[model samples]
Target: MSSFSADTPHSSSVMGRIFIYGILLIVAGYFLLPLLVMVFTSVKSMEEIRTGSLISIPTSITFDAWSKAWSSACTGVECSGLSGYFWNSVWLVTPTVSISTFLGALNGYVLTKWNFKGADVFFSMLLIGCFIPFQVILLPMARTLGFLGLAGTTTGLIMVHIIYGLAFTTLFFRNFYVSIPNELVRAAQIDGAGFFMIFWKIMLPLSIPIIVVSVIWQFTQIWNDFLFGVVFSAGESQPITVALNNLVNTSTGVKEYNVDMAAAIIAALPTLFVYVVAGKYFVRGLTAGAVKG
Candidate 1:
C-alpha cells in the first residue's frame, strides 16, 4: 500500500505539470497565430495569397513585397514608402524617451528624498494626468502646440509625447525611489552631498532597473501611437503609423495584400524588437517596488 501511494503521487505530479504546460502552449499559439499568418503572407506572392488559405505557407517565397513596401509602396499620393516615416519615428522616439526618462528620474528623486510641504498634494494631482484620456486633451493640446509654433511637426509630436508621458514615468520612478532606504540619502547629506550630487552619485547609479522599465514603456507608447501621429503631425513629418494607414487605404488598381502585410510588419518591428530584448528587465523593474510602494 505504501509503494502504491508513492507511485500515485508521482503520477499525479506528472499529470499536473503536463496540464500546466498544455495550457501555456495553447495560449502562446493563440496569440502567435496572427503574427505567423502575417509573416507567411508577407513573403508570398499575390497569386498564392489569393489561391491559398490565410494560414498556408508560401509555395514560392520572394522578398519583392518587402522591397516595395520599404521604398516604393504608395502611401496616399506619394510613393516614397516608409523609409522617411521610419526615420521620423526614430528621431521622435529618441529625444522623447531620453528627456522623459531623465525628467522622471529627477522628479522621482525630489519627490521621495526631498520631502516638502504640499508635495503629497502635488503628487496626487500629477497622478490624475495618468488617467486622463487622450481625447480629452486633444483640443487643448492642439491650441497649446499652435501657440508654441510647433503645430503639425515632428518637434510638435515630440513635445506632446514627452509632456503626456511624464506622469507615468514619474510615477514609475517615484515608486522605485520610495522603496530605497531613506537612510542612504541622510548619510549622503551628512557627507556634504548636495541634491544633484546625491542624485548623480547615488540614485542614477542604482536606478538601472527602473530606467529600463521607463525606456521600454515610453518607447512602446511613442512608437505605436497612431492618434497623436495622425492628429499632431502631417505631410513629410508624419510617423510610420500614419503612413501605414495611408498605404493600406490608398486606392490602387490592384490590392497588394502582400505589400500591406509587409508594411504592417515593418511598422510593428521596432516595438517587437524592444520587447524581445528588454522584456525581462521590464518585468524586474515593475516588481522592484511591489512590496514597498
Candidate 2:
C-alpha cells in the first residue's frame, strides 16, 4: 500500500477532531453570551442601553457609567461612591484571607499530627459549624458581638469573617495534610524539629498549594460577602458588595439599569481579577493535595 493511502485516514481523523472543537467553541460562545452582553452594556451610554437590543454593539461607547459606578454614584445622601466600599472590601478581605489561611494551616497540622482523646469530637463540631447556615448563626453572632461592644465595627466584621472562613479553610487544609506522608513528619521530628519549627520549615513549604486555595476561597467569600458585612460593618465600613446592593436597590427618580450593571461588574472585578491571576495556582494546589486524602 502507498503511504498516501494510510495518510488519508489520518487526515480524516484530524478533520473530525477539528469539527468537534468547532462545535465546542460554538457552545462556549452560547454560554458566554450573557457575560458578553453585560460587558457591552457596561461601556455603553444609558441612551444606547435603553434604545438598543442588549446583544447589539453600541454606536457610542461611553465610560460614564463606570465613572459613576466608581466615584459619583448616589447611594442615599452619600454620593462619594463605590470607591469607599471598594477600599473597605480590600481592608476586610486582606486580613480575612491571611488569618483564615494561617488558622487553617494550624488546624490541619494539629489534626494530622496530633491525636487526642476528644480530637475527633472537636473536629466534628467544627465541621458541623460548616453545615449550619450563616443565617442561623447570624442572630446569635450579632447579639454576641453587641454584648462585646463590637457590633457594626470593622473589628467585629473581621472576627465574623475569621469565624466563617475557618470552616472551609480548615477543611481544605486538613484534607490536604491527610494526603501527606506521615513518615515525612516523623523524619522531621527525628531531626529534633519541634511542632512550630517543623510546620514553619518543612510542612508549610509543601503546603503552598493548599494555602493558595484557602486564600483564594477566603478572599472571594469576604469580598463578595454582603450579609456579614451589612450586619457587622455598617456605614463607611460596608464592603463593596453591600454598596452595590444599595446602589442597585434604591428607588431613585428613575432606575439606572446601565449604572446598576456597571456597578455590579465593578464590584465583582477584584475577585474576578484575583481568580484570573491565581486560578492556575488554585487548580494546581487542589490537584496536588486532594488525591492524598
Candidate 3:
C-alpha cells in the first residue's frame, strides 16, 4: 500500500508537468507560426505564393526576393532598396542607444546613491515621462525639432529617440540599483573613492547584466521605432522601417509580397539577433531586478 501511494503521487506529478508543458508548447507555436509563414513566403517565388496556401512551404527556395529587397526594390521614385535606410537606422540607433543607456545609468546612480531632499519628487516627475503617451507630445516635439533646426535629419531623429528612450532606461537602471546595498557605496566613499571612482570600479562592473538588458532593450526599441522614425525623419534620413512602409504601400506597381516579406525579415533581423545573442543575460537581469527589490 505504501509503495502504491508513492507511485500514484509520482504519476500525478508527471501528468501535471506534461499538461503544463503541452499548454506552453501550444502558446509558443501560436506565436511562432506567423514568423514561420513569413520566412516561408519570403523564400518563395510569386507564382508559388499564389498557388500555395499562406502557410505552405516553398516548392523551391530562392534568394532573389531577398536580394532585390536589400538592393533593388523601389521605394517612391527611388529603387535604391533598403540598404541606405538600413544604414541610416544603424547610424541613428548606435549613438541614441549609447547616449541613453549611459545617461540612464548616471541618473539611476545619482538617484539611488547620491540622493538628496526632493529626490523622490524629482524621480516621480521623471517617471511621469514614461507614462505620457507619445501622441500627446508629437506636435510639441515636432515644433521643438524645427526650432532646433533638426527636423527631417538623422541628428534630429537620434535626439528624439534618446529623449523618449531615457525614461525607460532610467527606470530600469534605477529599479535595479535600488536593490543594491547602500553599504557598498558608503564603504567605497570611506575608502577615499570619489563618485566617478566608485561608479566606474564598483557599480558599473556589478551592473553587467542590467547593462546588457538596458542596451538590448534600448537597441530593440530604437531600432524598431516606426512612428518616431517616420515623423522625425525624411528623404535620405529615413530609417528602414519607413522605407519598408513605402516599399509595401507604393501605388505605382503590383505589390511583390515576397519582396515585402523579405524586407520585413531583414528589418527584423537585427533586433532578433540582439535578443538571441543576449537572451540569457536579459532573463538574468529581469530575474535579478525582480527578486532583489
Best by lDDT: 1
For 147-177, candidate 2 gives per-residue lDDT tens digits of 9999888889999999887877888888888
Candidate 1 C-alpha lDDT tens digits along 56-160:
889999999999999999999889889999999999999999999999999999999998999898888988887778999999989998999999998999999
**Residue 101 local lDDT, model 3:** 91
If scored against the real structure, what TM-score would every candidate get? 0.91, 0.87, 0.89
- Rank all candidate structures by their TM-score, best first, as comma-separated numbers: 1, 3, 2
Poorest stretch of ten by lDDT in candidate 1: 284-293
Residue pair clashes in candidate 3: none
Per-residue lDDT of 131 in model 2: 68
| C-alpha RMSD of candidate 1 | 3.4
Candidate 2 yields a Cα-based lDDT of 0.82
Q: What is each predicted model's overall lDDT from 0 to 1?
A: 0.90, 0.82, 0.88
